[model samples]
Target chain A: MTYCVGIRTNEATIMISDSRTSAGVDNISSYSKMWRYGIPGERQFVICSAGNLATTQAVIAAIERDIKNTAETSLLTVADMHQAAEYIGKVSVAVQEKAGGGAVFEATFLLAGEILGSLSGLYMIYAQGNYIASSRQVPYLQIGEIKYGKPILDRVIQESTTIDRAIVCGLISMDATLKSNLTVGPPIELYILQHGSLTLGRYRSFGEDDEYMRDLRKLWNKAMESAVDAMPRLTLS
Target chain B: MTYCVGIRTNEATIMISDSRTSAGVDNISSYSKMWRYGIPGERQFVICSAGNLATTQAVIAAIERDIKNTAETSLLTVADMHQAAEYIGKVSVAVQEKAGGGAVFEATFLLAGEILGSLSGLYMIYAQGNYIASSRQVPYLQIGEIKYGKPILDRVIQESTTIDRAIVCGLISMDATLKSNLTVGPPIELYILQHGSLTLGRYRSFGEDDEYMRDLRKLWNKAMESAVDAMPRLTLS
Candidate 1:
């Protein structure tokens, strides 16, 4: 299991992913779920994956191999974000089929970034290989253990939200998921791509003992406590 | 679909259930999901149900019939909270079996209350006619569209939490579910049973336009905004 989110605001695109992956309760390992692709200043893509680690790795490997070989439909060859999504979806489906096609080998992804002149966008690719873009109304897409982290996104994310706020919201969302679910753990990866930059804007990783992560958690916990305390008290008879 | 949660605190038991029932997006109606039974002052039970509406209705009807008929193992005759849970589970499985025992006709329940000379407890009864009690460490059980509403419970609920705080948390939890999922909606039914009272302490139903519900939502939204704003900001390059 994993948790990842991709948010496209007016100013930039933000992608966050937790590294923890669990085959079962006892067999847990850390694997980076976010992959960056494309040539700097030409195109940029961040793919955050969930579901079977094997399938995601295979699909990602296929993407890298295609890019290395300049395959006919590789990320470097795709004309737009839509084509990029389609190419990734095709690779994902082919990988799953090669793995014998079942629930165990399924994977999902959130693809976010710009294709040269195209506007920055976010899309969630399904296990079936179909995908849907995040709209101006929602402005975010999440994969894996999504529900625990969704309410905050639904409450705060909008097209007009600032890049810094979106980053904070994404981190808090990931933190909420990590708190409620054991399957999603630390060593979190976050990437930012300023709109039209055609380059990775900022990248940071937070390990379990990282100072910034600790401070963020403390601040968020305090905020939640204050929020809970401020709500109207129930008057029981 | 529905959202129901039962929380047992040191001072009381709190059960909250949304009243929305929908077979499809086009077909929606409201029905009370919380049912109170038992002899007040001697024994009391509150059953908050989710899943197949028909199966829940039948199970509730059967429980009422058994009590009215003075059957051997009715709620009135159950010796303890565990027996009450077993009785309800048995009834639920029987109802599902009568409906042909498939996912379509399955229902789950949260049974919370006290029997004379016993401590208050909360149990989550599954469709398979088995149940598990809420633990001191968790102090809560949720059924149906649970994840969206769970982080708050996981954060604040404790064995020593006061009844009023528990009720407020339960309402906020239900409100979160409502905000995130269309399948679960208002009006909301909340039931409170003070520990050792052996009676329903208070009951309130908030309709779609209820003043208190509106105020709570407003307050919570404001709290969330402030929380989001107060979180440490990211310094992106």
Candidate 2:
């Protein structure tokens, strides 16, 4: 299980992914789920994956292989953000082809970034080589163990949101998920892409001792308790 | 999709269920997922259903039919909470039998209550007629679209928790679910059973305009935003 979120805001785009991957309780391990592509000042894109570890890793590797081979449809060579999303979906489908089918090779990606002179977009790519771009009304997309952390995003995330606030919301959402689900753990990778910059900025990983996350967990618990205490009780006759 | 939760505290047991039932997004209707059985003061149990509405309602109807026939193993005639859980499970299995086995008939129940002189307990009954009682480590159980609302319960609930706090937590949990999911909607039905008392102490349903729930939504959002704002920033360079 995993939890990854990407938000396209008015100012910038924010992406976060938890590192924990677990096939079962005893088989839990940490693996990086965030990938970045393109030259620094030319064209930048971030890909965050969730689902089967082998499948997602294979999908990423296939994309990287395409880039190295100078394929016409590679993440780095794509003309725009939409093309980049298509590249991701194509790669995911290719990976699924290699895995002998039993259960569906479940994998999804949250792709966000910009091309130098083209549009910036946020897309959720499915395993079947299809994608949906985020809209003004739905400014964010999440994949993997999403429900545990979704309320925060549903209430606060908006098209007009700032990048910093979006990042904070993303982190808090992951924190809430981690608290409820042991499958989504720490060492979270986050990527920030400023609108129109064509460059990824502020890429970082939050580990167990990360002060912000510690404060997030503590303060969220306190606030929940306070909110519950403040609610007026119902008196039934 | 549905959402129902049952919490057993030292003071009382809390059960809440949403009134929304849907075959798909288009075919949705209001149906109470909660049902009460047993004599008022002798042995009382509250059951909240989640999953395939038709199957769950069928299970409930079967139980009611058994009670009318003076079956010794019926919920109304069960000796204790464990027996009551078994009775529900048996009914669930009977419902599955009537489905003729295509896809497994999906339904689950959160059974919580007490018998006079016997212990209070909360059990989760599966569609297969197997049940597991909640313990100290896991003092509450949720069925249906549980993930969206689970964080609050994970962070706050305990076996020795007060009924007042449990009730508040239960509502907040349901509120979180309602915010994130369209399938689980108001009005919300809540039941409170005091420990050692075989009768229900409180039962209420909050409609959309219910003043307390409205205020709860406002304050909860405010507190959550404030908590997010108060989290320390990541200062890594």
Candidate 3:
């Protein structure tokens, strides 16, 4: 299981994903699920995957392979974010059909990025190759073990949230997920892409022992504890 | 999809459940998932159901029939809390087999109660007729759409947590679930049973327009929003 969340705010689009994968309790492994594709200052796409590792890896490999082949419908050939998402979706669907047969080779993704001129956005790609972008009413999309971390995003994130605050909210949401579930764990990888700051190195990975991650976890836990403590005390009538 | 949470504390045990049941997105209706079976003051058990609505109703009907029949095993005939849990589990399995041959008549339960002289505890019964009790390390058990509401419970509930606070935590957990999930919603039924207060009428249902429910929802959303605001702002190094 993986937990990946993408927050699209007015200033920036942020995507965060946990790095833990386990076929079972005994076969636990760590795999980075973040992939960036683009030409610097022209276009950028950050993809966070969750589901079958083999399928996700295959999709990633296929996307990379497409970039190397001009004939293929690569991200570079796509004119807009929608086409980029559709291309990834098509690649993902074709890869699963060839590798998984009738079995479930499910891999969902959160794609967030911007072209040179169009609106910056976030899209959640389904295992079935369909996708939906974030709207004004809902400015975030989450994949994988999403439920554990969703309440915080539902409450705190908005279209007007600042990039710094969006990053913080995404980190808090990821922290909540990592604490409650083993399938999703650190190091958490985050890509913060503002609409125009298309520099190639706008990504960071917070390892298990990273100072900021530790402090944020402790801080957020205390904050949530206090929130519950301050709830109205119910009295028997 | 239902969301039922039961928290057992040193002083009191409480159970809260949503009232929504659906065959699909198009067909949905409200059905109370809470039931109580016991002699007042002498013994009482609160049962919260999640999963197939038909199977849950069937199990409830069977338990009621057993209570009326002195020959068969029933909640009344059970000697200890374990026997009571096992009896309910067995009845659940039998009822599911009868109604849903191979079509997955799954219904999970949270059973919390006490006998006249035995311990007051909580048990989570699986569809396979097996059950596990809550421990000091884990003082709460949730069924149905549990993940959305789990982080708050994981961070707040403890063995020493006050019954009032546990009730608050349960409410917050249920509220989070109801907000993020469609399968779980109001009217929310809650039961607060203390170690010694084996009283009837402790059960209350907060309807969609309940004032307190509205206030708590507003309060919790504000609390979470404030928490996100208070996070240490991240500065790119």
Candidate 4:
């Protein structure tokens, strides 16, 4: 299981992913789920993936191989962010064709970034190679173990949301997913793309023992207790 | 869809369930998911249901109808909490047999109570009639839309946890579920059982204006934001 979120804000785009992967409780490993493409300052794109690690890595590797061997169909050579997303979908389809083999494998990606003077859009691409762009009402998309972390995003995220708020929302959302799911663990990857800048900036990870996460856990617990205690009691007949 | 949770502590047991049931997002209705039985002083039991509401209600109705006709197979006549769970499982099977019609209708029940001088216990009964008792390490069980609210329970709940703490944990867990899932909605039912009390105590429902829940939502959002702000930045390479 994995948890990855990408948000498009008025000022920037934020992408976050967890590094933990597990086949079962006993077998756990860490793997980076975020990928970067394009030349810095010219055109920048970021893709965060979730679902089957093998499938996602294959998709990314296929896209990278295309970029290395052929420029016509590569993300870096795409005309705009839309074309970049199309390039990703095409690569995903190619990977799926080779690896699917009549069996079902679920892999999805959240693509967000700018292409210099062009658009910065966020698209959620499915295993079928189809994608949907985020809209004003739904400015963010989450993949893998998404239910646990969806409430915060549903309540707070919007098109006009600030980069700082979006980052906080993304983190809290991941925090909820991590607490509930054993498969999603620490060392979270976060990336911020300032609107129109095209280049990725402010990429980081929050690991276990990070003071902010500790405090968030403590405070969330305490606040929950206080909230339940303060709710009015319902009397039965 | 529904959300129900049961927690056992050294001093008491807590059970909570939501009233909303939905076949899909557009089709939703209110249905009670809690059932109680047994004599108040000698022995008492509470059962919370989550899954197909029709199946659960049929199971509860079957139990009540049997108790009305004969004490020999009644919940009130069960010798111990384990026996009571078996009785509930049997009733669930009967319901399934009557309405199942070769199709799978999944329903789960969380049974907890004490009988006179006997010990108190908590058990989770599945659709197939098999059950598992709660242990010290895992002191609670939740069914239906459980992921959103499971984080708080995973972090704060324990077998030796206080009744107040457990109650709060249950409420927060329910809150998270409610926030994330429209299928699990308002009018939450909560029940408490003190160890050796042999009776269910403190049953209540929280509506939209429920103050404590409102405060919890507010405080939790604030706490999450504060926690995110306090997170340390990763030094770049």
Better of 1 and 2 by DockQ: 1
lDDT of 1 by residue, B101-204 (tens): 98899999999989998877899999999999999899999999999999878777889977767777888888889999999998899988888887656898
- Candidate 3 residue pairs that clash: none
Off by over 4 Å in 4: A22-28, A101-103, A155-169, A206-237, B98-103, B159-165, B208-223, B226-237
> Which rank order by DockQ, best down to worst?
3, 1, 2, 4
User: Residue B222 deviation, candidate 3, in Å?
Assistant: 1.0
What is candidate 4's lDDT per residue for A1-237, written digit by digit as tens?
899998887888889999998888888999999987768788878899887777888888888887889866788678887888777877777777777543356788999877777778889998777889999888888888898888667666778876776777788788878887788888888888887665557777778787766776676566545544554443443
Which candidate leads in DockQ? 3
Q: Tell me the spans in candidate 1 whose CA falls farther than 4 Å from its real position.
A: B235-237
lDDT of 1 by residue, A1-237 (tens): 789999888998999999998978999999999898768889998999999999999999999999999788998998899988988999999999999999999999999878877777799999999999999898999999999999888878899988878888899889889988999998999999888878766899899897877888788776766677777776655
Q: What value of lDDT does candidate 1 attain over all alpha carbons?
A: 0.89
For model 4 chain B, the run of ten residues with the poorest summed lDDT: B228-237
**Considering every candidate listed, which one attains the maximal lDDT?**
1
TM-score of model number 1, chain B = 0.97
The local distance difference test score of model 3 is 0.87
Candidate 2: share of reference interface contacts reproduced: 0.67
Which parts of model 3 have CA positions greater than 4 angstroms off? A69-72
TM-scores for chain B, listed for all candidates: 0.97, 0.95, 0.96, 0.93
Can you write out model 2's per-residue Cα lDDT over A1-237, one digit (the tens) per residue?
A: 899999899988889999998888999899999998868778888889988788999988888888899887787677888888888887788788789743557798999888888988999998788999999998999999898888888877889876666788898789888888889988999888888776556788989898777877787677767667776776766
lDDT tens string, model 2, B176-233?
9998889999899999888776665588999978898898888777776666666666
